[model samples]
Structures are given as structure tokens and as C-alpha cells.
Target: MALAAFMLLLLPVLQGCAIQVTFDGASIPENVNTASVQLFENRAAYVNPVLSQTFTEGLKDRIINGSRLTLADGTGDVDFSGEITGYDTEPLAIQADAVSTETRLTVRINVRYENFKDPEKSWESSFSAYRDFPSEQNITAIEGELVDEIVEELTENIFNKAFADW
Candidate 1:
């Protein structure tokens, strides 16, 4: 039949145009097989005792779980090293009574990424994320939860910038 002949012809062309996709969206070069993440130091004015450790591990875990790169103690084909540059809280949503109705906690980090396989893609940048809570809430009581959420978001941003190639 004419329709059957047309379908057979199209199938070969379609097969030749098969697309390849990756779930993680990483576009690492074929030669880059390893990565290293140095401990992120806290250099903020008011440092959180555990932020350095928490952020450092979070970044390492993200790379390990999302990419095929092996973890290395020494510098690898891809390297990440940085520090926490800022951690501060500011009042937001001031009311008519001159009182703050909400407050925001912001965290900032500086990252240096080196791609040995493609030096042109290397970059250094700063990333920040923040969370808001009621002004009446004590920072000490909420800092842990807020820091965790902020770190999660910051790590994702850093990971995407470094490997997603977007």
C-alpha cells in the first residue's frame, strides 16, 4: 500500500535522527572524569559555627550525586574552592508603628570553579540566597532551619552554574 511504503521510508529517517538526553543535565566534557570540592570556610562577620562544615559537605554531595565525576582529595579535572563571604539579617516590611513585621536572613558565598579540560569555561562568582521570618521570631531559635534551607538553595545554584552549562 502507498501509506505502508511511506511509513517505512520515514522510519529510517527518524531512526537516524535519534536524540540523546541526560536526566541530570550535566554537560561535562568526555575527558573530565574527576572533581574536587575544598572545604568552604566561613569568613562572615557573625559566623555560624557549623556553616563551614555544612556548606562544604552539601556542595560535595551535590556534585557526587548529580554528576559522574569521581571525588578526589587533590585537585581534579574540575575543582571547586570557596568561602562563605556574608551572613546577615536585616529588617523588612516595616509597619506604620516603626516596627519590623518581618526579617530576612541572607547568606552569600564566593565560588571558584576550574575546568582543566576547558579552561575557557572556568569562572569565579558570588551566589546568595535568603529566607524571611516574622520579626518576632528569635534568630537563635530559627537560624538552624533558615541556614539549612538557604544552603540547599545556594548549593543547587552553584552546581547548576558549574555543570549544567546553562
Candidate 2:
């Protein structure tokens, strides 16, 4: 009975825990307090300026609110900046070329991130997204919607890579 009492008392200290980890590298500590997302610039023609702003803002929101990270304007633990490099649409599959029935809207982005805290490490990646719409030479409602959808997807991809560790 005395030995049993001793084991019971030691159980709490001897138990091992199973920790659920999310970060893949460097075990970035929680509340990594400060981030900055600059408005993405795009000089490409036929591109919407508002799209760039939306993507940039979306990324900032994801990191600040979703991951509990703070925001900085000039410098911080992390800095985000990028630009829209390409935006175009083309026929993905044509049927006899009779006013092509399917078109694909694609958006490309080049993103760069710096971890000043770790000068040796930085991340730079490019992500793109495309959506199909009814074929039309001139800009149409369907085409506009498709472009918006592609930009939205591209935005999510950027956010995922930055904060969600995707």
C-alpha cells in the first residue's frame, strides 16, 4: 500500500505529453508580434488596380487576425512585398475554333518575404490561379467574374504560404 501511494504521487510528473505542432521550421514561437504587408504593385496592362489592394489587404488580415501577429508599416519581424506580374486569358480548349467555347483567366504573382529576425532565411515564391469562362473576345460579365475569381484564389494561396505554412 505504501509503494502504491508513492507511484500515484509521481504519476503527474512522470507522464509524457503529446504536443500538436503546426510549424514546419524553426518552431516559430507564438505571438510573433509584428508584421507588415505592402500594397502589391502591377504595371501590367488590362489588370485591375483594386485587385492588387485586395490581395495585399487579405494577406495582412490573415496574418494579423488569424495568426495573432501584429502589423508594422516600415520594419518588423516579417515584411511582405510583391507585384502582379501577369494577367491574361486564353482559350484552354477549342472546338473547331467556332467562337471558342471555353476560355481561361490566369493571374500570376511574385511574392517576397523577409524575416529580419533571421537574416539568413527568407522566402520568395510565385503562385498563380486560373479559371475557365465562356469564350468571348471582348470583356464580358463572365470574363470579369472569372478574373476576379482567379485573383481571389491567388490571394488565398499567398496568405496560406505566408501564415498557414502551406
Candidate 3:
């Protein structure tokens, strides 16, 4: 509450100051005709279907809900495509008297953004997330949960990078 009150008090002062943020600087040209996002594919066999569907659908929904860009129903000006290129889990580090105690999950994705209205070159980006935790000697839903969080974060990240101009 104190922090909120302080923020409210400082809102006017902060308004005068430019908010400096950092993000991938992708150029979105003005007068885009339409924007289309293809359904993302899941290629990893070990990947949880829930995580895959949730992340892919969530991202598509976010774009549609948040952007002024129109979907390309065959005539859109811009095109966007994404695919799950990789998903793998492996032991990263061990601890406590040679007991395997750590594992990592890696999710790789490929994104393509293109301007169909002009000869503009497209943007292709690949990003991944990795998480490590105490290995239970057997894979469990814990890993799936971690992957879900990663997907949520990564989707938001990709969304921001692709359009928010953050």
C-alpha cells in the first residue's frame, strides 16, 4: 500500500520523465495491410500437449485481442508464422554426493514476420527458455508446470518483441 501511495504521489512527476525500456527493436512499418499468425506446431514428443496448446493458442489470442492488425484471411498485408522447433529436457548439473539433483528444459521457437505489401525483408527470430530444478529421479508434472511458466513468459516476450515496439 505504501508503494502504491508513493507511486500515486509521484505519478505527476514521473510523467515528465521519459520511461526508458529495453526490448528487441523490430521495425513495424506504418500502413500495414493485415497481419496473420499461423497456428504454431509442436514437434517435440516429450513436450506436454497442454503446454503446447496453451502457449500457442494463448499467443494467437493475445495478438488478435491486443493489436490493431487484422488477420490475413488470404489477403492480409503482413504475415506471421511460428513453430516449435525444439523441446528437450536433460540433466544439467548434479550435487549432494554425486546424486543427480538438477535438470533443465529447453524450448526453442522460430518466428517469421514479413511484409507482404512491400518488398520489405522479413524478420526471423528464434528464442528459447531454460529452467533448472532439483531432479526427482523421475520426470513429473513439476517439469510441465515449469515449461508452462516458460511458455507464458516467452509468449508474452515474443508478443512484445513482435509488435509492442518495446
Predicted candidate 3 versus true structure: per-residue lDDT over 1-166, tens digit per residue? 9999999999899656532222333344456646766767777666666665776676766666656555666646766677887888877666667766788888888887676756455578987887777787455757667777788777777777766555
In order, the Cα lDDT scores of the candidates are 0.89, 0.70, 0.69
Measured over all alpha carbons after superposition, the RMSD of each candidate to the real structure, in angstroms, is: 4.3, 6.1, 7.7
* lDDT digits (tens) for residues 61-160 of candidate 1: 8888888778987999999999999999999999899999999999999999999888999999999999999999999998999999999999999989
Off by over 4 Å in 2: 1-28, 136-144, 164-166
Residue pairs with clashing backbones, model 1: none
**Model number with the top lDDT:** 1
User: How many clashes does each candidate structure show, in the order listed?
Assistant: 0, 0, 1
Q: How well does model 2 score by local distance difference test?
A: 0.70
TM-score: model 2 vs. ground truth: 0.72
Clashing pairs in 3: 34-77
Model 1 lDDT at residue 139: 91
Best by TM-score: 1
Better of 1 and 3 by lDDT: 1
How far residue 136's Cα lies from its native spot in candidate 3, in Å, is 2.3
